[model samples]
Target: MSLPPRRPRLPLRARWSAGLATAFALALATAAPAAGGKARAAEPPYEARLAPYYGQHLDWHPCGKPAPRPAAGRAAAARERGFSCAEVRVPLDYADPGGAEVRLSVARKPANGPGERLGSLLLNPGGPGGSAVDFLTGYAGEHYPEAVRARYDLVGVDPRGVGHSAPVHCLDGPAMDRWAATDLTPDDAAETAALRRSFHGFADACRSRTGELLGHVSTAEAARDLDLVRAVLGERRLDYVGASYGTYLGAAYAELFPRRVGRMVLDGAMDPSISSRRLNLDQTAGFETAFRAFLRDCARHEDCPLPAAHPAANRALAAFLHALDRAPLRTGDSTRKLTEAQATTGILAALYTEAAWPALRRALAAARSGDKDGTMLLSMSDAYYERGADGHYSPLMAANAAVNCLDAPAAFTGPAAVRAALPDFEKASPVFGRALAWTALTCADWPHRATGTPHRVTAPGAPPIVVVGTTRDPATPYRWARSLAAQLTSGHLLTYDGDGHTAYNRGSTCVDTALTTYLLTGTPPTPHTTCH
Candidate 1:
């Protein structure tokens, strides 16, 4: 029930096949030369007001040093791989273009081409808070398919109120540590009051530190920012690859600028038609499905720590977490103990991908041991929270809440509503239901009122857009993808009948080949295409 981070910093070993070569060849044959033209000119009086912003130039330079340690090295490596960074200025409020402004941090890896360049392909690893800049310079810039890289200038923009782009600040490290350890599921009225206090304190800190900017970080604004980015990059149309929550951002952009959309691949899609409450419940069920899959896999191995039977395994894991709530386990760090919340976070982290299941197994086994070493699980929890070794936390969670809270009405207005919803939530996922139901209380005390509402995005005139879904994605459910694909006027659903979050580069050659072809040649796979 921790808000799912879009792209976890987990090892994603790439697997390629001979089919990719064929796809690449076909792509090259159809690919067109990159145009140096500006975006289609804006229309009318509103366009006149926004002219200066759209007309400004980008001053690209070697990427800046990242705050995190090893990241400095990654930035250098990205520079070596033809990556550069820049800042694009946009209005803090699009409605008031002449008002305060924020600068978007952007990183670009120019096309590595012996073939025709298609244009800039924007990438966003969604969080509503994820740093697309960090995602590019750290992993995707170097790891995306060489075929796609050969013809496209890969660009990543940290949307306003995220990363280096005038980020939203709430609790500092120590405060965040305390907040993260707060009991998520209340056992009684006193505990419930404590949880309310935690949410209120977080909201208060955000209002005090983030100021007016906190109210403006909605996905709708972020989508407008994406348009500004596209224009500044001199693209006639936007070509993009967005995963998880990024799909919603892309959908918004398409709805707003349908004709400006080009080749877009939305992997791990979110259904824009659903309310925040529905999204929470659906995601809760998704994670439960993923957890069960992990348990089944774990049961096959001799080192598995839980009972082989599914129901027994679920009960056993639940008991372990509940026991931790009563008496936390010792992590190697003397300063920190693994509470039930942290353990749940750690378990959810592994459920993002099956690759992390063995690590989860090891961590659980260690915690069950006499020594009660909780180091591994604690480490994973820290990673999910984007906490550093130096005990500093990123603004990821703060910005995540800011954007989400502003995008929709509170899932539940107060504890009473949450209590009323518990029965339904618990039925959705016995292990995660209660905590996730409490998570709905997060936006109840937000300083800003909701500015957007749930609605289906048709993007009526947009070009063919591919929507990828994993059968067992833990964060965004496959059904959401189906719903989104059905909603989008031009959507093509490409299904990966496998486990894990997104499908494109996880391991499926079929998924990768289809996606690569679409990006390179503007051809969508057949509708409702299923790939194993």
Candidate 2:
């Protein structure tokens, strides 16, 4: 599925979430460009003036030490896999290359084995807002097959407004704590107004603190930046492995540089053709599918968290959510109560990967037992949201909103549109439907307009690209992968009939081998390669 909103994403309440950690954002927006807005004109042909950037060499240094992995492991894991951090200077606004320029933060883990280097394998884990720098060294660099690593240097770039690039700073911890806890499932006019105020405040904070950068963080610009990064790395064509939202970014790059696409793998593919509303609707359905799978798996296990679950897991889940909605659950930190929103988010976080299912079971059991810890619900929510131990929050969500709202037309015009859509959203997913419907409104108030349309990305002359989809992916749906693969001129579809947000290295040697072989040999999987 395309990481939409920000995805290819769900809405803000859904968030770049797949959490408050595993929460999938509310995928959203209605069709086409907004009323009274003009599409951005095609970029000027690559001009001579851009050579300074494309040709400039980056000064590399040891990547900076990450914040200690909060004793809680909420922050990214300690980046033990070493990589060189380099600064790439690219135009803040590509339309005006000579104007102000921003320095993008990039990291590289050089080839390890004794083999000819096959250029850099640029890596991104999606999020529009996901950090590629840490990803390059942490999970990716550490886990990529040794053979693939021997031939290609791993590269990561924190797109213009994300991570170490010109970071987007909005609200601080206290403000974000309130923002994250704002209830999307509003009951009364007062609650509705409060939620609106929260969305409004978030939008206002971003605009106030980073307005100059917000409008420019569009995926198109980020794609252009990707090209510059490619050229600067001395690679004539791009080789990439992008997941989740990264799939959309990778697809954009291929569309922009069809001729320069050497090898690409879009795991958890996103359909660039849909509107934000459709993205939300599809993701709602997608999550329900994943959640159902989780239910079956949990119910069969001896250690399943809910002994009384199943036969009707959806009803059980709904009841659980409703229980929290009635009264905030007490927590170890007396000051922090697990509100419905936080509880819902915590539950969603575990749905990202099956490995988290048991943990979810355990957390839920404690909460049901009325443990003051409120179980690990709040903790899991905090992890998915990237809440730090120091009470600070990363700018990921803020930047996620910035890029998402700018990339697509508004999914829900305002509260009324959302109210009307609730039934459909609920139909899509009884558990997550209502909250998701409300999040589509997050972008209706965005300050900028979209430059892209819901058009197919054929990448007409690009080299072969690998597009992956998991049958029961919780974030990007499997159909999106099928759709994206069909759209690309040389796209190869690799299906993992499995669960989780992504599929490359989760557990299937079948999927992993297919991907690494393609990356190493320049051979795409047969047009239709299904790995079960």
TM-scores vs. true structure, each candidate: 0.93, 0.90
Per-residue C-alpha lDDT of model 1 across residues 1-532, encoded as one tens digit per residue: 2464475332343311111100100000000101001112235687689999999999999885564332454677777767899999999987799999988899998998879999999998877778788778766777788899889999999888988788999998999998888888889999999989999999999999999899888877888888889999999999999887778778878878889999999898888777767878887888889989998999899889888888898798899999989999898889999998888877877777777788779999999888888888888788777777788877878878888777777788989998999998889899888888887788888898877777777888899988988899878889989998988899999999999888877678999999999888888998668998
**Residue 242 accuracy (lDDT) in model 1:** 88
Model 1 error, position 352 (Å):
0.6
lDDT value, residue 33 of candidate 2: 20
10 residues in a row with least lDDT, candidate 2? 1-10
Q: Rate the local accuracy (lDDT) of all candidates.
A: 0.79, 0.74
The TM-score of candidate 1 is 0.93
Off by over 4 Å in 2: 1-45, 65-82, 305-311, 370-373
Candidate 2 lDDT, tens digit per residue, 1-532? 1122222112122223233342332233222221112222235465477978878998887665453232224123333445677889999877788999898988888998798888888988777677777566545676667888888998889898887788777787899888878887998999989988887788888889996887888888888888889889999989988887788888888877788888899998888887778888887788788788888888787767654454466776678778778878887766688888888777766777676777888888888774635748888777666777677776677767777777777787878888998999999888888887787677766677665556688887888888998899877889999999998888889999987778776668999888888899988888667898
lDDT of 2: 0.74
Show the colliding residue pairs in model 1. Answer: none
